[model samples]
Target chain A: MIKVLFFAKLSEQLGTRELLIESNNIKDTEQLFQHLLKYQADWSGVLNSQIWLKAVNQSMTTKNVVLNDGDEVAYFPPVTGG
Target chain B: MISVQKQDFNQQVEYNRLKSKTSIGAIVTFTGLVRDINQDQRVSDLTLEHYPGMTEKCLIDIVRQAKARWNIIESTVIHRIGALTLSEQIVFVGIASQHRGDAFAACEFIMDYLKTQAPFWKKETMESGETKWVDAREADQQALSKWNLENKC
Candidate 1:
């Protein structure tokens, strides 16, 4: 199972702090997005937006990065405040 | 290197704790406080929100970057989360270096990167009876862009 965390407006919209996804292990970013889209109707829209950034274990990542089991991935809006 | 907590911090306590005897000569610290006004707008209180694990990691990364650039001797960072009112201390960053230049530069570098890159969010409650989530500033992105990551994108 892969761990997923959300933040800010994304967290408010989802109404859940963290989510677990049982999958065949994601090999690419596209598959990760597809897998997450299954969990919620609006997941795709939120994840695919330009303002949102994805991080694996707290490191900024490219969309093409692969994933592993038990890895915590986060989707959060950009930091804007001083 | 990074702490995002919900409790108030004691400045002298934190400062003394980071006073390590290493390759040090100077220590520069920055204390971020909750101000009464923002851009002439009367802010009654400020709410600080942070991503659980993400904020700490992001801050560590920024600190590591500072280490790469400067010969830092010691460092301490304390950030508060949750609800905060006016005149409260928001953050504390301490940097010790062999000289003043590196200490000053690195301290400023950390603050700039922390303000623009970290995942902490803020919502302002104004005295005029309106509250809104603070928007991300384009100027911050521009500040971060001075680093070499534009083409990498």
Candidate 2:
């Protein structure tokens, strides 16, 4: 199980701040992202947009980063907060 | 030093705290207030939300970036969270530098970046009792772009 969180515009569009995904063989962020796409249509736009950032465990990460059991993952729009 | 919290800050105390003995000559201060109007609409109050641990660390990182760009003697930032009434203080920024120019520019620079890059979200209450989230302004984005361009140069 991996916990995924969204914020701001993403949150409003998806109507939730957090989501849970279940996978036994999902090994990397790319796989996690592919899995996420199935859950919502709004996510597809953000994922396909240019220059959006990704973070895992509070640090910025790329799509290829690996995940483990109970790991936290977050996706958001271009982080335009202050 | 940076803090993102729900408590109001004392400007004088924060100013004195940032003034060190190491060649400090100027202290620049900026205080942002919750105005009665936003987007030409009469506003009653505002509720600010922020990421708990990440917001504080992000503020400190912004201050650290200012330090890298200038000869800052010291700096302090206090940002208020939670619900605030009209005419309430929202944030404080203080910067100490060897010269006034660096203090002024860095102070403005930090505030500019903070407005766009920080994780704080504000929802405003209108006179009709409606709540609306504020959107980021294009000017704020352009303000950050100046530093962005400078970094690459």
Candidate 3:
């Protein structure tokens, strides 16, 4: 299974903080995001927002980054802290 | 060293922890405070949220990058999370080096990158009892761009 995380406003909109997805067929962050879209109607709208940002395994990454089992991925809005 | 905690930090304690040997002649410290006002709104308090594991990794990466680009001898960073009231200290960065230039430059570099690269987010509570997630500022992104451009050549 792959671990998925949401933070800040994204977590509020999706109403979920964590999820575990079956590792089959998901190859990259983009694919995982698409897989998540199936579970919630508002996921697409919130994720597609201009301020959305992502991280894979605690590092900032683009959507094309390849994923592996047990990897932790996070999606959230742009950060606003010192 | 980097710490992300909900507890308030003592600046003098953090400063002494970063003090280096005799060869290190300069120390620079910066503290970020929670403002009571922002964009014409009166902010009463702030709620800070961070991606737990990711927050530490991001901060460590930023510090590593700073060390790679400067001759820094010692450095420490402490960031507060969770609820914070007006005028409370929110973040502290301390750096020690042999020269003033490297100490100053590295301290600023870490802060600039940390502002954009870290996972912490802030939600502000206004005096009217309304709360809103603070928007990311373009100014912070621009601050990061300068470093990227300088390092390219």
Top DockQ hit: 3
Worst 10 residues of 2 chain B by lDDT: B144-153
Score chain B of candidate 3 by TM-score. 0.95
TM-score of 1: 0.83
Give one digit per residue, the lDDT tens place, for model 1 in B38-105.
76799999888887777787788888888888999889878888889999999889998889899888
Candidate 1 positional error at A2, Å: 1.9
Fraction of native Cα contacts reproduced by each candidate: 0.52, 0.32, 0.78
Using lDDT as the yardstick, the better of models 1 and 2 is 1
Among these predictions, the greatest lDDT belongs to 3
* Candidate number of the best TM-score: 3
lDDT of 2 by residue, B127-150 (tens): 999988787678888877888734
* Tens-digit lDDT string for candidate 1 (A1-82): 7788888767776677788887466766568777877767887676666567777777777667777777778877777433
CA RMSD of each candidate after superposition:
3.2, 3.6, 2.3
Q: How close is chain B to the truth by TM-score, in each candidate?
A: 0.90, 0.93, 0.95
Question: Residue B106: error of model 3 in Å?
Answer: 0.7
Which residue runs of candidate 2 sit more than 4 Å off their true CA positions? A8-15, A23-34, A40-54, A60-70, A76-82, B149-153
